[model samples]
Target: MSRRAAGVILLAISAFLTGVKYITASIYSTSSPNSGYGADSFKQWLDYVEGNLTTYSMIVLIAGIIYLILAEIDDFDKK
Candidate 1:
């Protein structure tokens, strides 16, 4: 519908994703080598995620920004 509405929706999605990322990264993570930082297993993705708070935030922000940019581009192309 409107750019404002789309922006708000994107922001909400970003916030949700970012919150999940942070919660799993911080509270759900561990410090022991047998837990979050073991020398093997796929659970390390969780630890990696925990170590990249800024990255997750940037991803969220990038999503909103990409939406904004696409909206602007569409408007420009419509001219």
Candidate 2:
């Protein structure tokens, strides 16, 4: 496939994963509807989840870069 098409597919996959994460989190939230305490707890959980997502995304990005670099080196060696 073309590089542009591969990029678009990866982007779409990432978006789909993000949407699923958000929807699942929403469905699992058991916080009270009228309690500020519950809201505070839920907010903390949301913050933690967001932080984790950011960290995982960064790791994945770095891994992809590494793979691309290695692939390029391997291709150059083949010429």
All candidates: CA RMSD in angstroms? 6.7, 5.4
Q: For model 1, give the RMSD to the true fold.
A: 6.7
- Residue pairs whose backbone atoms clash in candidate 1: none
Model 2 lDDT tens row, 1-79 = 6434444555555565566556555554654464344566656556645755656555555555555566677668879
The C-alpha stretches of model 1 lying farther than 4 A from their native spots are 30-47, 50-79
lDDT of 1 by residue, 10-53 (tens): 77877776777656655444544555444443355455765566
Tell me how candidate 2 scores on lDDT: 0.56
Let me know the TM-score candidate 1 reaches against the reference structure.
Answer: 0.44
Stretches of model 2 off by over 4 angstroms after superposition:
30-41, 45-79
TM-score of each: 0.44, 0.46
User: Which 10 residues in a row give candidate 2 its minimum summed lDDT?
Assistant: 2-11
